[model samples]
Target: MSNSSKAVVSFIVGAAVGVAVGYFLNSDKKDELVEKLKDQKNRLKEKWNKRKDQLQDELENEFA
Candidate 1:
């Protein structure tokens, strides 16, 4: 894409993210949103750790 096109796309994405953050900050359900985000974060961490352990075990078995 052209430079101007890239700039426009970036601006649009930034505006969309700003609107989302503004809505969440202003909404009455902010606490619920925070809880949901935290839960998602935890689940992602668990999945990451599990994958890392699996990779480590595989490497050990391959080399051992």
Candidate 2:
């Protein structure tokens, strides 16, 4: 497999391990974990939207 494929497999394995560990370790704090994850997802989405808009503007400027 290519380097990128290997990287993707490694990431998937790591994420699985992380989720399993988190689930086992925080059996009593599920609600808190869910809230934190939701907040993090919202922040990441906002950042991605801003970055996408910036890139779109740059592309339009370059071609206009």
Candidate 3:
């Protein structure tokens, strides 16, 4: 597609995302949603840290 077409598509997608985020932020359940997102964030961080540690240990063993 042309550059102009791509730009238009990107703009539309961005606007849609902005609207959705605005709706969620304005909703009554916003606090609940935020709490759930925070919990999910924590879970992902823990998982990532665990995986990183495992990889580090494997690399150390390989080098040793």
Candidate 4:
């Protein structure tokens, strides 16, 4: 293979190996991590929505 092709193959192999190792290492904690991330995302979204509503209400009251 050409040098560029060799590099591409090396990169793909390296990525696959890295993902496999990381997956194996984190398999047990994956669910817990995912749940925590989901909960955090929900909380942030809720806070943003509430702030947006409050701002909108203020703007309406000020101009009305």
Candidate 5:
């Protein structure tokens, strides 16, 4: 209903999907898959953080 609630729900859903994908990939490739996923996760975090920071800056500027 609220913005925070929607954000929380989105985070939970994203986490669930990530875990499921990791589990399946790990089952097939074991160590290699785990390493690949770790790299992907790090990249995803960096990209997401950059985008989020940019959006926040834009919003702050707009409001200021």
Candidate 6:
């Protein structure tokens, strides 16, 4: 009922859904799929880092 509890529940639900999707998507070509997923994960991480840096710069500009 509390905000923290709601957030935790949401995270658990989302993780479960993600796991189910991944499991269903896996196949005989697991090696290829794994490589593709690794590349996608790296790309996502790069994008996230860039966004984080940009947000930090913006916050500094606004607050400093």
* The best candidate in terms of TM-score: 3
User: For residue 10, what is the lDDT in candidate 3?
Assistant: 100
lDDT of 2 at 36: 90
Candidate 2, residue 64: Cα displacement in angstroms equals 0.6
lDDT of 4 by residue, 1-64 (tens): 8999999999999999999879966799878877888999999999999999999999999999
**Regions of model 2 farther than 4 Å from truth:** 1-26
**lDDT per model vs. reference:** 0.99, 0.94, 0.99, 0.93, 0.93, 0.92
Pairs of residues at least 3 apart in sequence or in different chains that clash in candidate 3: none
| Model 2 lDDT per residue over 1-64, tens place | 9999999999999999999988856898777777899999999999999999999999999999
Q: Is candidate 5 or candidate 6 better by lDDT?
A: 5
Superior candidate under lDDT, 2 versus 6 = 2
TM-score of 5: 0.55
lDDT of 6 at 33: 78
Pairs with backbone N, CA or C atoms under 3 Å apart (clashes), candidate 1: none
Clash count list over all predictions: 0, 0, 0, 0, 0, 0
Q: lDDT score of model 4?
A: 0.93
lDDT of 6 by residue, 1-64 (tens): 9999999999999999999778757867778877999999999999999999999999999999
Per-residue error for 30 in candidate 3, Å, reads 0.8
Off by over 4 Å in 6: 1-28
Better of 2 and 5 by lDDT: 2
Q: How much is the lDDT of residue 42 in candidate 6?
A: 100
lDDT of residue 43 for candidate 6: 100
Local distance difference test, candidate 6: 0.92
RMSD of each: 1.6, 6.6, 1.2, 5.6, 10.3, 7.5
lDDT of 5: 0.93
RMSD of 4: 5.6
